[model samples]
Target: MKNFTRVLLAALLVASFAATAQDEESPALSISGSVDAYYRVNLNGTNDERTGGTIAPGTSFANKTGFALGMANLIVGLDGEKTGFVADLAFGPRGTDAVFGSTTASSSIVNQLYAYWNVSDAVTLTVGNFNTFLGYEVISPTANFNYSTSYMFSYGPFSHSGLKADMAFGDFSVMLGVFNPTDLTDFNPTGRYLGGVQLGYGGVYLNFLFDDDFFQADLTAGWDLGESFYLGVNATTASDSFYGGALYLQNSFSDDFSLGLRGEYFSDQGVGAITFEENVIDLTLSANYSIGNLTIIPEIRTDIYSADEVIEDADGIDVSGDPINPTYGSNLSSFTIAAVYAF
Candidate 1:
């Protein structure tokens, strides 16, 4: 961990020196970032004493029912005339969780480290690791209207490492990419590659990805109703009977205050060790109050489950030394208060 930090500091020093030595004609470097913290209290009082059912489901930012640091994100970028790069770093729970296969806490700081080159006015190429383009929700809390995430975004790929081309034609644009296996950040485990395509026009976008016989598709659409209201929708489905959809609506009553709501539904097929039907419905209502660079978000979320699987429990019926808790009608609800400062 110390070595990694030293390398990062060295890279920053070199970049700073190079930027200082550049002439006025060189593109200026830009720095921007956001930091967020939040507190949450779950109505279910879920505990991890038994292991499977204690953790809050679907809520990523405020997974615990107390004050926590979401992330301290620092983004630096340089856009030259024909070549540029972006280096993003983060340190917190959100950052650690977004890294591919990052199960335990560590000192990895890189969230996105990618460079791009402009091939022409309409074509560009980018390489290295970047955030996944498959879902509407992102890892950044400042970018999302709701603090809690959806099932689709929570379970989907967080980032990809590979190369891709971005092409624009009139009002339509396309992105084609070849990526390493899902959730792989440091190295590629297999020789197989995942291919992705993003097609967009106006306020509507469609994405498709395929990997080793498994395919996923996503669609996102946005519309502005006059100047005060907006509507957005996201629907995604993957092979193996995994699918989810979310509807978002927001209304701005004032310049600094707005109300937003999201309704979602998700389902998972019995493909793993568990063999029971599973379905989830969640609803979240959130409010945003902006005060200059700082924004306050207060949200309420509820989740309902329709499942027949039995999870391991501590005091339930024992089977081979493992107790089972029937999870047929269990549900969860929580409230969060979060604040974000961006520059």
Candidate 2:
């Protein structure tokens, strides 16, 4: 027993020394990441998904009843007081392509890889692939509050590759980037990364991206009304390729209980100049009660689509209204309820 204890101590000492050596070799490097999983059944789909049972659409339970859909990210960063660098890797099931044997479109591997070097307290330069500055929500599900993404979030400019820079002072920062267009497979462009900027101060933020083929602009702001009530508003307008934006408000009466309501209006111009008008107003409310390690979350949501929004023909699908192969514009009104847990 004494010999075993000595051996264990020696192993621990070696690990400590290795870690020290690593720290000395890269004094600025740090690693951090997060994983999130949820079981969600969409009641808006069909009876097959909404069957009333344990984790059904309308039940209250600790475990969500659905497939394990989630996201994970690993961020490797380096810092040296005023200067810093970051590389992020993203992966999950929701974004995989069905042709690759995935239920949904989830890409595999390090899709988002970028490096930024801070040159001064007020400015920094970045290169590689990164997310575009355009939405209220992001691609990372672990960082989002809702299980399903909004219409605006699904169709916005995703990312860019090339030279980017950010300037910061006080509570406001301005970012500008140029990227190469890589079609649908990637965010960076083949010749340029496009060009974009975000300007914000206090509770408000605005972003703009302009390219030879397209231009996009978004305005967003949030107000925290005292203890638990807050209001958030955002709007987006883009040239023919994308259409999505929402204005909403959220409130929390207590630590374990909260509610949210939002009104959304959207429209999209698909690839090759096919246009679809989308206007909708959605109402969603959710309640959560926590007990120790278990949390009971019940949510209710409703959506109403505008009359002029549905399309009868789309080239991507052979006759758009056909249910056998409906495109993204076929259904405008859909609702969902889910219960989730964290372990």
Candidate 3:
């Protein structure tokens, strides 16, 4: 049934685009998507039970023939001399969250909708749904070197529905926007109305987003050392009604055929009921030899959580700390092997 719906929608979108196309001879309409297939073997047994910053059922690593429509995005893009429009839609298994209280999965909807109007050669105005410009991590799995989204990315605001403006100055570009503060929250709470700013140049980036009760700022930088090797780092600080001011850092090392390492640490400054004043560390390293269109990527990653105190209920079980044992599995780890494509 779901597969049938997806096919139907795809056809409908194409049909609408064709019917509305004025020139019929212009080559401005482009439709594209990708296929990501993989096998992920989680060492934590099938019933290990999840207790951290994730949307899986248990703590165990998950292994399967994975395919998700949400991971694949479709965009109806129309480009002209100075104006462009895009209506983005998504569908598939790897959707952001499962229905609350039920393990059943959720599908997709219109994730991004916006238009770009260039006022001058160095500036443009955009109004609609787009990715936030703060974190080094992104929600799209294929856009990332790894399949898992970072705690920082998942923890921070995902997307905002609003209007924005952008400007280019020599080697850098600056973006600022206002959003309705509402987001696609797994069909739960209505988001907060907020705004943010992003500036980027030469692989270095910085962003700031704020609302009635939350304020966050992050910085990122990346470097390529030639010889198939690269390194990147991200740092963030924020304070919210639920959690106090906190600091974090994440880093990555990548090479052609050998290894990659990732690590992140977070500390609290006094805010939420629990404060989430815990430290988490994670790592992933992989190796592969590529030939033409395919390459095999086998990787391993872990999560470690720690705190001075672990709160508990009357039963002597950790009821106050995060669901994932921030302090154990080397503290926590998952492994995978996947083949991705680029064109």
Candidate 4:
């Protein structure tokens, strides 16, 4: 940790010197941000009222049946001719959990704080904390197609702190870095390092990441069939125990309205003492309506489980241990409505 801190400080000093020597005019600072909120409901009656808990299928942000605060974000940035810095901060439930791994009041609040020096037209160096280069979906609600999330995106690494060098060759660009462990948001480093690479060509992108205990490779492709139709896909795998993928399609009827559909499949290889593995498939359909700066999303999702494990009741009894909850059951459903305002 100490060595990492020393390296970061030295990098900052070098960036300041280069900026001062390269440009004489002052750079203007910029600000931008977004806010979001949502409501959710489980249609399968999966709520355990005795415990005030609900088990919604797949990965969901608004887990409860009432209105909820999603997040409010603020970003401040400055750019010189050859140097730049960004400070992104967030507040509310989703943002807090993304940084601290929980919704606790006392925790780190900074999402990303990084400084970069453009070495040349094709090379750049960046240091400090930044978003992970591993997934297609982001933590912010305003960037996702559906209001709810997927199992793969929810379990993947969210952010990292490191020093990276990027080089570009026309349509191809690559980035490599080394630094702390996976989800450490605080300044306490783990003395470990991670490596990441991104390769892109027009509409197709591939990402690779590796660490001591985990390795992930993902691919995303987007195509515009016409002015009113689009297609997208994401396939990802992590370690030896998990793999998942999703297909997305959208149709635009007008400038103010559109609809999207997403279908996904996920599998788990299981763990010790657990005799059964899990295979699940889900489908989601959503609509987007734009009104100036605010966009509203109404989404419905359904999940189908391939195996019959056990379902516990409110008192923690295995209601499905002997086929009691429902002799043959394998489906769950949910709905959510979200509003996001970006500026």
Top-scoring candidate (TM-score): 4
Across 77-113, the per-residue lDDT of candidate 4 in tens digits comes to 9987788899988888877777864233444678888
Scanning candidate 4 in windows of ten residues, the lowest lDDT window is: 320-329
Per-residue lDDT of 309 in model 1: 27
**Alpha-carbon runs more than 4 Å astray in model 2:** 1-25, 42-45, 49-65, 95-107, 182-189, 241-244, 269-277, 287-298, 307-343
Candidate 1 wrongly placed segments (more than 4 Å): 1-25, 47-54, 102-107, 270-277, 308-329
Cα lDDT of model 2 by residue, 1-343, tens digit: 2343234335433433333222223446688765545544434433232122121211111123454544456778786543445676555553331012112234344445655554567876666566666777666543444445555655555555555667788998887555455213344223333556689899688988665667778988888887888777778877765565576677777777666665566654553211223354545554545454334444555544454434222222235333343223333233344333333
Q: Please state every model's RMSD to the true fold in angstroms.
A: 8.1, 13.8, 10.5, 5.0
Better of 1 and 2 by TM-score: 1
Error of 1 at 161 (Å): 0.8
* Structural similarity to truth (TM-score) of each candidate: 0.82, 0.67, 0.67, 0.83
lDDT of 3 at 189: 41
Q: Give candidate 2's error at residue 72 in angstroms.
A: 3.0
Residue pairs with clashing backbones, model 1: none
lDDT of each: 0.76, 0.52, 0.52, 0.73
- Residue-pair clashes, model 1: 0
Model 1 per-residue lDDT tens digits across residues 1-343: 2343234334433433443343435689999999999988765534444334454665455677577789999999999877788998888888887884633344267888887777679987777778898888998888899988887888777888777778899889998777777767656767666777899999788998776577889998889977999999999988855788999999999999999999998887643311334778889999999999999999998877676322222344455644455343356677889999999
Residue 280 in model 2: lDDT: 45
